[model samples]
Target: MADVDQVRPRQAASPSMTARQRLALGLLLSAGFTLAVDFSILNVALPGIGADVGLPLDGLQWVATAFALCAAGFTLLFGRLADMFGRRRLFLAGMALLGVASAAGGLATSPAALVGARAAQGLATAAVTPAALALLTTSFPEGPHRDRALGLNGALMAAGFTAGAILGGVLTDLLSWRWAFFVNVPVAAAVVAIAPAVLAPDRLGRRPRLDVPGAVTVTAGLLAVVYGLTAAGDTSWGDPRTVAALAAGGVLLAAFWVIESQVAAPLVPVTVLRRPGVRWGNVAGLTAFATETSLVFLLTLYLQKVLGYSPLVAGLSFTVLGAGTVLGGIAGPKVIGRIGGRSAMVAGFAVQAAATLTLVRLGPEPSWTALLLVATFAGGVANLVAIVGFMVTATSGLPDREQGLATGLATMSQQVGITMGIPIMSAVVTARVHGLGGQGPGAVLGGITTAIVVNAAVCAAMAIVAAVFPRREALTQVPPAAPPGT
Candidate 1:
């Protein structure tokens, strides 16, 4: 097997770039934003979709789960493929697939068709996301330039979720929920149209090889694990299918590790996992995503179910969150430069923990505009800070050849965090509510508060974990080179 340094190019991007390069950056950012938007857009539109297609509640759950499973399962494989083939090629192809899937989803007449389209869209997203990040990392030198670009990228992606939630509600109310899916078709079409001319193709020194066994086992394992988690939330962890799925997933993952050890060219190189940055960065990423997403999910329910806020009002209330995130994104690079990535990440987690704790004040009847929005804004800022910090720390110092791998790992951590968080926390809420055995609004408030308090404690623990992160220089150190002449 070739060393990473052997496969990577030595030349760095010039600090100054041409107009076309800037356009390429814009397109890449747009692609990432679109991916984020698509994921969240369906959140608010699920009820409408269920009604339209006559989908049972159980089937509707799969609409989101199917997408999450496919995206999480295939992301690493596609990331490696991007490194092997061409980032530009995979990116364009992914965009094309996304567009087609979006159209199919918009035009779906049956439940299976819609769910299948969503799964296809997720697969395409898995392909596009890491490739886009790799492209961005390669396009700029590792310094303030890259930091600034990454910050902006982080901000836009974060903002996309907020925008999607709002847009989904509006589209579902004003027109039809189908428009939520239809919306992506045009943005993707535009990206496909412009990407080829603006973005440069990656050059490979040698033909790439695939670890088919590793890929198959890992993907299947992830799918099974996600399915089990999703099932556990709806049913019980003791359910036969859930137990069987979890057990099979564990065995498959263990088999994957053995396969990876023996493979000449493994899908995920063991060396990658050995890197301090890759390891801790992913841990921090998972914690940040899980805690933040859980808080938002719980708070959204609190606002709508307990407070009886309209969907539009609930969506609009996130303005503080969106604005704070954008501000934090603009400031993230400067903060990281001053305090270092480790410190920034630690601080970010601390802020997030504090914000989540503040939400514990939520009650059956409380003011929505003041205290709730303030906490949301703080959480939003911390989110941007945490995301940018983890991203830079994780991907930094990775050779050109491994950029895809680094980004893939980071993105997968995030996906897994979100997928795991919602189900686990929802189960917590369910159990708490069931234990209270009350059919009143007060019981709902008590349950939500209890669950959120647990979330806060988790965030605090995550912050301490972040505090112990490796130094920036050590985290970003390049791997040792191969012998003089391969």
Candidate 2:
């Protein structure tokens, strides 16, 4: 095994974060949290939005689908744009757009209006996520400080999703479903207001020309792919719409590959993909997100369909898992410092697999204490650790100039994983239930159990892959971040 230092030289020294830097970090995290929350915030509100707007079920689904498609599709394009233009400039523009879109969503009276707003919000998110992450990576030189910052960012982002789930229910019940969208307005406003004061301005020089053909083909390809996967979840892989969309996406992506090869300034530079950390690290990230998200989906079904928990109760139950994620996020940087990112990531996946497997023992009437809480909590912790480690590994050796592209690719992996995983697992659960020849609680339990096992298997397999791959070395440590108020 090689040392991380072999892959990339260490910085001269670890610097303590200034108060302004801390404020900047906070702003970036706030933007990330808002994006994460929006990803799931509308889930519970979907039915309400449909009813109030008199939307048909099919149209209602677009509220979520539009966001997923646009966010996943435009991320890479915007990431490169941030690199070429300016991260801070892109960040501010994204936040402003997000705020406007949120307000539009809240005031929407028609299905088309609402879906359009969601799509705009997704576009803004695609812009903001990579730019904010790039700003963070560039602002904090790689070392313990960078690792710690990334860890905290991962933790908060995960927590934001959980918070959105619970808060969506609360807002829908107490006030209105529109509150879910309205809530982001103030958060975006604050971030946009404070960001310019704290974040360093982007240094402009002779910038490379944009790769228009590569950008267009890749973005269109990603949109089609994500749309197909999203449709697969609602329909089936064999559905004509799914088939056509996926085929079109593949063809477009192939064209993108050819364009990138020939272009003077490719949207995604081939050299970046050649890095062991970038390649294998994204694989780890994709697997980590896919399995963990599928587990959550299965658990939601188990809690609601089998155990008969209310949607609100099921949402609240995962708070334990969210708490564990928070703790793991706090501990992740330290663990990576001790063992290296590769080791920590492998261990995180291994532990997550074991934790997921424990739930295979769950009966129709299982002990929530022994099974649900424990497993979820442990899985949550392991999931965040793996995520943090993956990010650290993926961006480890990249120059500041390329941080936007790296972070964009990293975020894109996550969105693709989340979009792809649920559908695949849903297919598995459906097959298992049908094979059992029943629609009763017993069949549901059996199907859920099978899905859980599959999730564990996937995690274990990825762990083995991460362990066996020798493209990169373990992350090297530096002096820890200075204690607060020091």
Candidate 3:
């Protein structure tokens, strides 16, 4: 593995170049914003989409799952690509592809076509995410500056989720569900224009052989695992398709690991995974995101179905949770800087778990208390706080040269969290919600409560693992401010 500190690039973005640098950062964040918009915006629009596309409930879930599965599968692939080629090149390519795919999704002819387009859109993200993060991490000095940048990046997701929920409802009600994708076109166009001018050009490091076989294996493995979990809600565990996807996923991933261990130019450096901080960060992120994302998924559905909310109201209902995440993401760095990363992570986890517990008391009847929303919102905020801390902690130790790959593995874990969350929670909910005739709302509420409780348990477990976070390093206040090499 490349030594991170040695390879960390110094920022030439200076007094005169501050505007350009900020623009570059903003554009990079736009990529994140676009992703967030897609992620949650679909939650509110699913009903309209299903109606337009003539999809059943299970098929409707696929609309979302397909994007996540493909996105998660390709996360490492793009990460490796950025490492092999150039991070900036891939970033630009990803933007172009994302824009094109977004347009295509808006124009999709059939449900299958839309699903295919969404998957293509997911692939674009696979390219942009790691590369964009690498650029920011390598561009700045590791301190308050970089921390603020990361915080802003985290804030984008919260803001984007808020936008998505509201926009999803507004578009579906006033215009068309396709407007969600259409919205990205103008934003992406603006970014593409400024990116090359503002962002530093990509420079390739060690030209390691691309691990095509390993990439294929891991991709297949992730796809299988995600598919199996997603199908668990609609298909029996005994079903042949479910079994094959899961088994194949397992075999492919195992083979990939074996191949990686033996190969000199492995796609994912084994050493990085062995690093205590990196390993635990991934574990913590995966579990935390899974629980939190599942709550969003299950509750969004229930708000619409059980609570009898329109898409607009359901989306607004999520706004409270989105606001909490934004606040958490924005404030996380300051807290970390004052105390430390570990403390912030653990404290944030506590807040999130407490928020999850708050959701357990939700019922079939509406309450104006706002505690549920506030608690869930706090959980969302805590999520960003913890995850961003995890990112800083995980990547801080790596040398500048390998930041792209490091960012890849780190970001991919979040994708895995979301991918796994939906299916597992759905399956559990469906199983329990059955056999309740005429008490549909009660059944749905029961399922949602169970999922949130499980999510809470996941957060609690994360707190335990966080206790083992390596020696307290004063967390970076802003990742983008870091000197190229920490």
Candidate 4:
């Protein structure tokens, strides 16, 4: 990838956007927030849904897995479709589908029905998310304005995930788990109702042939990989079924690369992945997302199981993190404006690494008043900064035609990191506890601390990687075009 100093600098005289453009950006950000919320909203609702629908634990796990499989699997396909057809049309369709799916999930009477509804929600998210991102990147010219917009987008996305954890628990306790899914209905309806008026229509471009084989292979591969990873959490990673699924997924993905090399219009062109910025930025994004999420997952367990806090109280404690995330989001653009994307990203990673290291002080009798709260808040802020910086760098130099692919790759990296992180980290915690050889509080604390130390090491490694990345000056410099296609 090009280093920060290598890209052409933005012209001193940057043009301003109209009021309609600002409104369009707001609508798109709202869409992003809802989709992010939907990703995690069902997590806390799992136990309740399982009881109501008479699902065993294995079946219950699939309730969340089903959504992830479809969402992560189909995102590239929908991203390409948006490029072929129209982003606005796809966005509206996705919103409609999500509204319907949310309602179905809310009213589901059987496990099959709920799982199917969750899958539908995932498919809808695949469409809605990439379209919204592509639209935003194309709508705003790349400069300080786009940087600020993306900062808010990254903020809302992180905020939504954090908020969902708390909101899901609240809704499940006060009303019903069903209300968690139901909550998206009105939000989707509002966005769908207003989108047409605020967003500009895409002009007809030469549509490419849909790469069906590539899409099928990739989708199947992702499904298998996600299933394997999810299974590894419950059963041993050495389990035959888990091993088989992972191997199959690898084969399919290898086959997908072969198909892409020969196809007329590949779903994800190999050339796109070859870009240094895109490749490294996604690597940074995946690392940041995985480490941050793993930290949160371990924190929740420590608070509830080890420290004897209620689920609701543990969830509410994240408010400090949430506050820091929002503030960090607001500050990210300014940081980028000063230091540039690469430097900002490296700094973010460094901050988060330091924050994670602080949590190594965690003990059997925790000090929530000082150490825990400070580390949590710092991690949140650093996470948002890294996220925004990685996103900005990844998609920085791409043209409008490739915006969908760029955003799709960025989003996919995040999903894959999250889907894989928890299981892997949980396994680490489990092995550590087993080695320590006791169920006592001290042993439990040792295990949690060990897992966090691993997370800290990962963060530190990513920071080193980010620091060593070659400068790509093209990322900071804005193109002269005022509109997307020009």
TM-score of each: 0.92, 0.95, 0.89, 0.94
Model 3, 176-231: lDDT tens per residue? 98998888888778778878888888776568788888888988898888788777
User: What is the TM-score (0 to 1) of candidate 4?
Assistant: 0.94
RMSD of 4: 4.5
What's every prediction's RMSD, in angstroms?
Answer: 4.5, 5.8, 5.8, 4.5
Q: After superposing candidate 2, which stretches have Cα over 4 Å from the reference? A: 2-7, 12-15, 472-486
Model 1 bad stretches (over 4 Å): 1-18, 366-368, 469-486
In model 4, which runs have C-alpha deviations exceeding 4 angstroms?
9-17, 470-486
Top TM-score model: 2
lDDT of every predicted structure (CA atoms)? 0.83, 0.87, 0.76, 0.84
lDDT of 1 by residue, 1-486 (tens): 222212223335355666876898889999999998777788888888998887887788888888989888889888888898888899999999999999999999899999999999999889999999889888876766677788888888778877888888899889998998899899999999988789986688686689999999999998888888888877887889889989999999999999988889999998788776678888988887787767777878888879888887788788788887888788888887667666778788888889878887776665544888898888889878988888888888788888988888887887778778877788788888889998567777787888888988887887787665454434357468898998
Question: What does candidate 2's lDDT look like per residue over 261-373, in tens digits?
Answer: 88888999988887768888899988987887778788888888888987788888888988988998999998888778887888999999999999988877746535889
Q: Which is superior by lDDT, 2 or 3? A: 2
User: lDDT order of candidates, best first?
Assistant: 2, 4, 1, 3
What value of lDDT does candidate 1 attain over all alpha carbons?
Answer: 0.83
Per-residue CA lDDT of candidate 4, range 187-251, in tens? 89999999989999888588888899999998899888888888887676888888998999999
When 1 and 3 are scored with TM-score, the better candidate is 1
Flag the better candidate by lDDT, 1 or 3: 1
Angstrom error of the Cα, residue 195, model 4: value is 0.4
